[model samples]
Target: MTQSPSPTLPGSRAQTLASAESLVSAYEKAGYTRAHPGILQLAEPFLDLSGEDIRARMFLTSGRSGEELCLRPDFTIPVSRDYLTSEVAGRPHGYCYLGPVFRDRGALPGEFLQAGIESFGRSDKAAADAETLALGLEATAHFGMDTPDIRMGDVGLFVAMVRALDLAPAWKQRLIKDFSRKASLAQDLDRLSLATANGRPDYQGVLAALTGSDPKAAHALITDLLSIAGISAVGGRSIGEIADRFLEQSALDASATLPPYTRSLIERFFSISSDPLEASATMRSLAHDAGIVLTPTLDLFDARNAEIARRGIDLKRITFSSSFGRGMDYYTGFVFELRDGTGEEPLVAGGRYDDLLTRLGAPEPIPAVGFSVWIERLAGGAS
Candidate 1:
């Protein structure tokens, strides 16, 4: 027999019905349909997309037959699984889900309501990102909450910049994964420089250690140190290897810590006020000045900004902050979070995860992005 629900389970403020109604209604207005009670999905798929951080925070179990399972942590995976297995293919499918998602433990994580939308088979990536972001904003507005402070970032753009510098593949991957944590990233770069200088056995190992930062001085130091070490007939790490690491690390750090003019240019892109039209120009000008001439990544940013402008959304109300990273590995492009401006944690966050669908083994790649409003956070904010 299945375990019975506790009396308190039915009384969670996080499961409040009115909020559910409001969330579902906003999703409906955005063309998503109520997606039913939902199916339980394997935890590994969601963990794979969410990366190690979420994996560590999960509640997991095994069945009587010894099959591994996990309490459903979020709605996006199960919904995507349904779309992939059902007749929803060959046509666009927009779905909204509201139900209990289980996480291990937090302030209020035994069970919580999650409301979100996922559109599969969508071709217009930019429009899709904009529409999804708008839905979250509208939902916050519906709650009569203060206007949300919205900022956006591009993970793809960041990775593109890393790749363009011609850094080693091993080093590039490390930086991309650790870009969100500034201090950790810097330390990683420092260690990589030191290892390169010390004639470490594996260049790749040194590269991995250096993943957190892109600093020119560190790179130069590594090169000079390695050249001196190499002259003494040291270990496996070569003089060329040391110099390469130095130059790569230096260039990477230098780019991240751009000069004043370039920094100002990048800063202007982050200044997207409520006017989407003005924000689009800001992004275009900044990208142009970044000498991102050959990179379609910047072009994509401009296109998405233009789409937001075309939608007649007030960009001034939504700040186009360039540094606004969502800090998840799966977000490929157009990430944003909605905060209540009281200096509290973000109430909602969402972004495009085009690579995630393919990573999750969908029948075909689906360009999808959506946001989850932290129900507990919203409730606390309201109270």
Candidate 2:
């Protein structure tokens, strides 16, 4: 069974509820219609789109028919799923939600209130991105956090850099998949730079033998070997999965070493972290120096900054770190977190996730962006 938060003092609970209501009211007044996604949601979407961190933390259960279900871990996926099934699925719409999101936070409470807005089908990507960040700041202000620390990043910039590089399709996918995972991304960089199988598994000989061979034949050979060894499976991985891993390894083994210049360019790109405007200039200069085209992505970045400034938000207060990510796979563009001075956890966080609606089953891509306010965190800081 899933655990809920322990009972709080009535006064404290009431105050938190009031704060959530106030946030919901604020979002609604800003033109978002209230949305109440169900408490119990299908688990597969979260398992697929939220990445490993959320999958491990979700409180999963099986329905009567054996379908996997989970207490909603976050509002984004659930809200998107709802929108996909609603009449306004493909139309421009804004949704605001305030409710408990369940997750296993170790010593932290398993359940806590989250309030936020989701704006879907907005084609004006830059303006939408700025609006989302501006609203996130407003959420902090609502909790008396007048100037919360704003840390921002644009994953699209990293994606564009990787795309412009001369890499095999598999390597490009691997690098992009590892972007949200800092440690994994570092290991990838190290392996690419070293161009050696130094930290590889002991089965390097097998990978070497399979390198440059036909993938289907290689898979068949591995399956046959496993069968001959009377091993139908290893650990929890099936024969197909095991074969796929070997194929991936073989492909990696066959690839040429990444050129030192290319590696240096990637490293330089990841090293950028500064004021949004300054970061934009640095990125443009880096691209120009490297003879790569990143104009479209950088233009959007600058336009987003311009939009934010137009809203009267001080650009100097926003810190954009190229390597920073929210660790969620669905965020495709700008991401950010707002934190009070006293705590390490963010009181408000969000980003642009344009592909999520289509991933959830829309006919075509619909632009989406939003943020969530951690009511409990804000209330705790206020107290």
Candidate 3:
């Protein structure tokens, strides 16, 4: 028997092209210079510089020189890297791109088009945030999306809250790192609760193995012990990989956990959520209740929300979820996602990644914000 052909995607090829063109045009009219950095980017930066979210999904390949490479995952990083190395390194500029990106999408297509705008070196925080937010909404509307679910989050605010808390150093580091995943937060806190109640009985053992340690001797000892126990890399994973996992779990077992009160403070912070317009009051109330003083970061969030309103965006369309966080670690400030009720994922997603330029080898920090419009999701989000 012959297999059936795959069904056509939503919106015709022409409609998709038209929507993409409209998106690029909207960005260009808003001051972006059309830029196509092309496909085939170096894979190391995606591994070292980009967030872990995209690291595993990248379609990696090897070059003639045996250097690791990958098909462009997104225009944002390549475009930013280009900008950093160009003559316009530190100056203000807006870049727009529309191109195909490759990745492991599971059931979805591996190759799909993405159109985006990256505004770099903008000194005005509020303006840049507002512009990126507005541009995303406007582009969605331009594609006929009505009333997109404009959900917003602030990694900066989350970091500020973590910093404001009086927690054990280990707990703080763990919380900050795991904050991006909402589900993991609860699990980590639970582990902290149990671990704190019972001190790590193996702490001394870990200290002995990891400290004053010659790494080579440690490796030899570990291999010998594993070999003696008939333990080896199984399930298709390498022995090195198994050893690494063992070491990581051992470290976790050895880590000191937070006191109950510090864990309470973290749980309380995560519980805070409300409408975008009243986010300031909501956070302020949480602060007062917890007796923790949120820094000027809260004020910045409020100001950015106000500036977003000034850009004429309807606040009713936006919701602030304290638990929401983009998986991308480079987002140093405002983070948001715009979704259509019709789709499983956000149609337009972006945030301020101020430190990306520096990671790309730029001499100085470049304040940047941008959003990518998923061509495949525009019509779905619109409906």
Estimated TM-score for each candidate: 0.71, 0.90, 0.85
**Which candidate order results from sorting by lDDT in descending order?**
2, 3, 1
Task: Please identify model 3 stretches exceeding 4 Å from their true place.
Answer: 1-11, 168-170, 208-255, 380-383
Off by over 4 Å in 2: 1-9, 196-228, 232-235, 381-383
Q: Could you give candidate 2's per-residue lDDT for residues 1-383 as a string of tens digits?
A: 21223456477777767776877788899899888898999999998899788888999999999999999999999888888888998999999998889999888888878889999998898999989988888887887778989999998999999999998766787899899998998888788777643445566677678887787888899999888988888888898888888788667755635777888899899899899999999999999999989999999999999999999999999889999889689988899999876687788888999888888888899999999888878887331
Candidate 3 accuracy as lDDT:
0.78
Two-way lDDT contest, 2 vs 3, winner: 2
Give the number of the best model, judged by TM-score. 2
lDDT of candidate 1 over 1-383, digit per residue (tens): 11223446556553455666666777777678677633455666766677555676678877777766787776767776676677875367788776677766667547765677777777888778878777887767766675777767777766665565444565566667776665665665665565445543435455545555555555656767766664623355556565665556644443232234533443354454444456456655655666664257766766777677677666666665444566567777788888878755677788877777777676567777777777666666331
Where is model 2 poorest over a 10-residue stretch in terms of lDDT?
Answer: 1-10
Residue-level lDDT of model 3, residues 23-78, one tens digit each, is 68777887898887869889888887666668879999999999998998888888
- TM-score: model 3 vs. ground truth: 0.85
Q: Cα miss at 45, model 2 (Å)?
A: 1.0
Candidate 1 error regions (>4 Å)? 1-15, 37-40, 195-294, 381-383
Q: Deviation in angstroms for 341 in model 2?
A: 2.9
